[model samples]
Target chain A: MSDLTLTPNIDGADDYYAELLAMHDGLSREESDALNARLVLVLSNHIGNRTVLSQALAAAALKPIK
Target chain B: MNQIFETPMYAYSRHADQDATTPPRHKVIVVGAGPVGLAAAIDLAQQGIEVVVIDDNDRVSTGSRAICFAKRPLEILDRLGCSAPMIDKGVLWNTGKVFFDKRQVYDFNLQEEGGHAFPAFINLQQYYLEKFLVDRVRELQAEGAPIDIRGRNKVSAVGTHPNHVTIEIDTPEGSYNLEADWLIACDGANSPLRAMLGKDFVGRVFEDNFLIADVVMEADFPSERWFWFDPPFNKGQSALLHKQPDGVWRIDLQLGWDIDKDHEKKPENVIPRLKAMLGDDVEFELEWVSIYTFQCRRMEQFRHNRVIFAGDAAHQVSPFGARGANSGLQDTDNLCWKLKLVINGDAPESLLDSYNTERVWGADENIQNSSRSTDFITPKSGMSRVLRDAVLDLSEKFEFARPLVNSGRLSVPCTYDGSPLNSADALDGPDRSRPGSACPDAPLTEGFLLPKLAGKFTLLTIDADAPDVIEEDGITVTRLALSLKNDPTLALKNRYLGEATSGVYLIRPDQHVAARRPSFDDKLFRAAIRRATGKE
Candidate 1:
């Protein structure tokens, strides 16, 4: 059984996002773009399992096309 | 071990007042006789303006400063009448192969499309480039062009007024004061004039420093760019190898932050490092070695009252993408035309505002690209490093990920997209010749489209009869025609007249597309020229 819940696991996601934006306060558009790419990759590698990673990727794409 | 370059002295410093014919005021006085200043002088002289350029040094750049000359710069240099020598002396390389560790990650080529005049990239020493430009300037001067280049004359103080600038210059002979209706500072990154003006270059200064070495050797290496991230010889760091003319190989090795530059640049240390990458089998001589810390920075504006800035004095970037000198060449290309128009009362003085705006956009783009390339080569933090490694690893296996790889996104002409100067394209024409973009050069029956356009507002009509040269409101527009007969491969037609077919384009003197319309309407074309000329 896979332990990937796809639920909001972090206690204070809002606080984290606020901190993220704050960290990105003075960064240029290019810097912000690089930061985001890195964040996604780094966070993904921390999650680290093939089945769990596939599940997360599929879940992320479940939203209606914007 | 310490091999210094032997530079020929052009003109020694002379007493400023020694010229009994010294005018109280010149049309434009350029500070710094480097490539940028010399190019600007030539452009201004072509417009029939008097220019006096003074430099602190009496020779060209000591080292091979900017080695990679991009195509757009070559075209601008062509107009200034000095591209042939560069092309002939340069090692033209259109392909670049990137590697990760011991494996070749991805390779890219710029020659996927041909038929244009110049190659995609030419690796030539900046010294030769400057020398050729200076020779052209001197030749034009001998032919009665009013461009004066004075060496060993340094600007000690700068005084800016509403209409003019007064500069105090210190020469070998003595000190003298000169006046200019307009002054351009091409004094390079460590510009004294920029300091005198009290403008700070605001941007990030990278922590890492790169050890640059130009070694001369008769090796059988092909003309190609070789870049490696964490190569075996230089473990955990990046290495770049580029070919230069005269059997010189320019090698740049990344030295991490907190490097003792003097210790590393010593020939004994540098030779061992070179031997590490290049086997002892190769007989190489150390030519020049220096350590540089890259900074992607620029002034908020390139124009300040009567003093405008072009090239390194206005902006600076890392040597990664080779945009440093290439973008400066573009600055002269962009500024000279507008300056000419304003000086001759052909365009409003407000036109100079576009130079500040457009070049700021250009500088931002260069800075962005340069910073990104630097980050990719030497990531900032742990997470960024992880992602960069992933990008490099994935680049080899997948075609999609290959585009994500940033091995110095080499220099390209900046399109003035979203520029207000553009007359919106109501007509659907080819995407290649979009308004506010540098028009693609095509081989015509004669030579090329760029040489044909030649320093004038051109109404380039394709597959249609061109209207006569229209001169109105202090603007003279030339009509240039191209048809299926002239271009056998349909390259020009395909490039300029795309979907919905034949169109007329309003081209600026700098060969940037001002506007494009599918239908031949004289009024719309003239209006485009007016907008491009800053009359609105």
Candidate 2:
């Protein structure tokens, strides 16, 4: 349980990725940025455990910016 | 041995012997006599502009359609001078409950801003709304308002010129032509004018279908909205139950796509489903039923030279939120004042562009919210369904997940946050009275703030010494003072001033805050009014 649970939890990951891309189809850069911000907040609220979220954030930051 | 609630017939005797050769001209001709068209006509006539309204139908809507009237429309109608009778006839409701299967999940009060003049939502038949508006129009006509509402007059052809539109109308007697300097189309989703112009309403059409049933039943159900997701009786579908005046209950059952609409509409099929939801012991007579598939769409542009679109002609959304008619009323509210200003030469023609800008923004907001609600209610994919079910399940346990449960987002008036007409609030006032928002109505000593601020630009000086009412050609300045601390629970003061001691608010004819200052300044106040009206 302590291990970072990051291995493809969402079923049909490719379809979800396509859906995510389609959601940003018509939005401007600023609107897309705002959407990302809102998504972060909403998902953060869903994952209510603060330590788990902190661990996820740290794990995410470990990856270098492309 | 049966009695029917027949709509009183309206006599349309005025007929011009003109065809395309000798068309009678008017300042503005509004098509469709639904709530939106009548409201637009009444608002325009009140603004001292003559209008001619034409409708294909001769009576009020046959069924109880568009039953949910939001507070924003109630306030607009109040300004138009016919909200009293509507409020009396409408069933006032503010609370709603959400259920998952057999368990009650959450409830909402819509605890609207305290001291606001109207409740959040009122359930009234569309027919009663039309009847009251027509009566008001007749009374105004008798008192020398140049507004003519011709029933059974349908527009068969529409042609737009640079300065005017010539429409061919087919009447019961015969068809004739009329010209208008401007044409306001309040026609519904299947707008003939839009079709004639070849403009398509652009957006998503969902595959889900819902059967809306109105039944006349005498039951002890509370007058509140109840929504169920996969309720026990309805098996795996969603259902909604709402109360209306005259012992009518509206039940919307989610019937998945590809179902035979005619078969589902049959009493034999409808009664069993309703019986499952509301036990077989309860007797109800079927009144009306319709199958609806949600379509969230809007026109690219609302204005086309001399022709403008309002109501469902301009935009449409899913019925989940009560956004359809409420947003349409706001469309007319935004439009009539601008059209009047342009016609009377108080503002330039370019002022109309702001109406298009603001209402399109409003429509997009409504469509987005409505689409989100529809998506949550009818999850299309397996992943979406799982996530939605998780949210619903978690909503029963966790308080944080309650907001995620999107049963239906109730309609709220959209604020034009970045509108060009909104003057920056220098006083750092409260959000309620901020620029580009409808001024929060509070109980003024005279009456309510909204109605008192109608028909002209108003300068409201609150918590300050009463300044004599300023009389401008198209502006009115009224000053009233109520001690912020001494006022009743400080609701009014909080709505207007927040922590500030005194301020002056400049409001537009539609009751949107144009500008606000900590104290009165003649130069700054007039400048704000000029900018708001595009006189600058």
Candidate 3:
């Protein structure tokens, strides 16, 4: 069982999105990629539960056309 | 072009001080006669303080600059007895529309909680604002108020001393020295006094230019603010359209950094840009045109010994939020009362420190907000631009995303939440009226609450009991007793007493809550008064 509720659970969602984008400013494309990877790893460690991590990963994955 | 700006309202005149053998020391000397400087002089004069206002220029500002005046400053001006003309002449507006590319994202109404005397905002040229303030000064003068405004009088040098400040003033005839117990520097953004004191504003200088075109035309456009982000007329840049009184419309177009500012301001170049924005079919005449580059900066300390800075001399911000002149008015509103108390020996000089504390906090808030708005309007990086566009794109559909659209969070009253003057809050009232916050206006059975409180230290008791007047440490706190029994609307109760059955609020002279309790306690009220007056 997974305990991940992803129904827009954040206040000021636009603020968060803008901050995330601003965090990448002045960084090279390769640096941004590495930064994103490191951020994923950091968040993964915080959510040590494998089931929730797998659920987040599955939800974030690109969807295919039917 | 209004001929009012050209008329020399305060033309050169020789004063008796210029010919005196010995320099006469003034109670308070204010430099600059712009809106902020005149406001400071008028406020001090109203408090029975002798104040002299000196300016290098003889007339009001030329252009239709600082077109937006928010409600808080209007209320302050009302208290100063000059809001009537401004409100009559200003274009009242509360609705603003935001656009992204060629489509409208959303329109917002600054839902002003009613029961206040003033509107949410007004668009009046800076010349009219200064002219009204100058007229009010004359009214005070006729009433024998100790206020004198000297035109063509400029302060060349300043010498700060222990008890007073010495200043060298230059007039049309010659130069003379004058002394003042206290000096107020409202000399504008490029403050000469700030420079003479060997101090400078320490903050960010935004790298962008904006062209302001004030057009005189009889248009059917509603009295509302219209902002465009990446419009068809100007690609990849922001633009603002605002209506002013007298059939004048203010248009601001963002120009990227590194451009020929002077060349861009030429009528040949400006007319074409205006034609692009407003189709060539529309008939209009260019009243005034200018280019401005803004910076968000302020002095580390607004007060330095006997010399205190106000208005643009103290801090400046980008014109996005309409914060510059509005916050400057707030600065004078905060300063005059404390200065009156200190000069009259009612409060300790340390009370002035709270002015420094609270206003610096206010300046930082204004700077931070305007800077954020600037960033959203002009993204520094490609990714930031993408994020900004995403917000705008989502705002077209999602209601939640609309709040993220920052078309310059307009100026509002600054609440001194963590101010030293604010005592502990013990009332379970609405957070809007919490300690250190400006008292939200509510209607009474007879009239509005703010006008009744006026500009005084008041003990506002709602459905509670307190004496008519309480004196503590040479300060008098008058009681404005109110009861919901008379108020049929329950607005006063809802605004002042939410969960609590009764409430007692000790409001400062500037109408900011100093301390509040569920009910009045004598000892606690006195202590709070002491704290607010800087005795504690």
Candidate 4:
């Protein structure tokens, strides 16, 4: 049952990761990698995106990427 | 006693202070009756002035704690007429959705880019908005109006002299001394008279703690706004429910920074993590449970000598983006029309130092946009939680990553830019720049909007034969004819008026446009009403 139809074009970062899997009915990949590094700096400071936020900060390797 | 001072505005100011031994002076007092000091004592007793107020609490604070009001604080509670009975006992909400984990990313409707007249939020229950503002300051003290409220009086001291502001009080008939001619302080956020004026509140504190509860539910859950990212029973928690008006529900969780704040008042460690994230035949009961702990602070000054400070005693944020009591009721609707134009000398006292430099630059930009929405919903490491879960897993297959997975940039509105009541047409062009922001609510007819020309001091022409520019010191225009099928973003009427010159605008009695001539020149509409009532 996942064609993802909570609809209304869900995108505030996938409706906050489907409201964090309906408030954690499931999640554990170390709590979805600690809420995806705070949702890639909160959706890269809100939608300025920076190339999928530098590929999610080089797949979460995170450093001073000046 | 004696029917509570037999109302005729406190029995004609206590029979015009029969042989006064003190207790009469008040061109403004107002300490804290809440709802931004009873909306600055009902907009300075509906502009006739006087106003007293006080309160150290004898009533009104059942703690529902600001239950969302917005639509610009219901057009500043429809200019003190009490927003149609707090919008007929509140609960409007125009869609908000956002859940990433259970998959459903963004949904904001707010009646999609529409006009405005109240609908874009309204929950009502900050103790019934302070009992509908203490029943409109007891119907302006039974329609006589000098306004005085007392309530177990408290202010235990506050000197400031230069032409009045003595204060002292302690009541239960034991101590007293009150003089006024100015003193505001909507005493909150521990503002004991802004700590008896040694001011300097500065910022940032967050280590995150949240918890809140307020339940009742028999779950069918539909009133939108749920939010739960990564909530496996408190593994780095984050949950939020909402919907409240009777069958109640206001949840919120977040807990991080390693628990133990009195083991979060165990109800068996919070009812099995709210019955494991609300399921298992959802029942519900909790009704009230708190824990909160945020601090984004502000007050470097919201006026000092003569006293003034509104809401959370001038700034404190981190309810994420509820923008702390709607920016403390827009700092009591921008310091009640600049303290009713400097106690009615119609401006000067340096327009009350531009209400502490535009509400301390709107409380340091709403505490840095609610601390960048609490660091994008709690990301304190683990590579910022794997870059916030790879942007919620590439916002589930991008569309230019859906407005960065729907953040709407901490709901816009924060613009003052070096204030001193900003001018050069509120700092030059782009159709009257955003001098201390808030205005933007367009779309006119068809179920009337354009902020129902919000509470007064409006102009907004858009050429319905634009002429009558008023302001010989009465400033309350409302024209609004606007066309092009009411507004297609009109991109600010085609970049500051030229799609055949129309929109005049102006606004500000805290509805905020404060200059947008584009065309209808009458010395740029009386210099945008003397630079929005600070009489340039």
Best by lDDT: 3
Model 4 CA deviation exceeding 4 Å by range:
A1-66, B1-20, B32-168, B171-174, B177-228, B231-261, B265-290, B293-318, B333-335, B345-394, B404-409, B414-471, B474-511, B514-517, B520-536
The TM-scores of all predictions, comma-separated, are 0.88, 0.87, 0.93, 0.33
> B1-536, model 1: which lDDT tens digit per residue?
32223564457646445464553688999998888999999999988889988898878887788999988999999898999999899997777899999999888776546778988778988988888988898898899999888888889999989999988888777777888999999999999999999987988999988899888886788878889999998888899999998889999999898778889988988998888888889899888888999789999889998999999999999988899889999999999999998998988999999999888999999987887778778877655566578667756654545555666777989989887789997667777678878988888887888898878888888876667688868988888877768986677877887665677888898899998877678777777778998987
**DockQ (Cα-based) for each candidate:** 0.05, 0.05, 0.18, 0.06
lDDT string for model 4 (B2-111, tens) is 12112222121222332358765778888888788888888878877888887766567654666777666676777678889887877765666666666666555554
TM-score of 1: 0.88
lDDT of each: 0.83, 0.82, 0.89, 0.67
Q: Candidate 1: lDDT of B418?
A: 80
Give me the runs in candidate 3 sitting further than 4 Å from their true place: A1-22, A33-66
Please state every model's RMSD to the true fold in angstroms: 6.6, 6.9, 3.5, 19.9
Best by TM-score: 3
Tens-digit lDDT track of model 3 for B146-193: 999999998999999998999999988989999999999999999999
- lDDT, residue B422, model 4: 52
Expressed as tens digits, the lDDT of each residue in A27-62 for candidate 2 is 776676788689889988988777777765765454
lDDT of 4 at B521: 66
Error of 2 at B335 (Å): 0.9
lDDT of 2 at B228: 94
Q: Chain A TM-score of each model, in the order shown? A: 0.75, 0.84, 0.81, 0.24
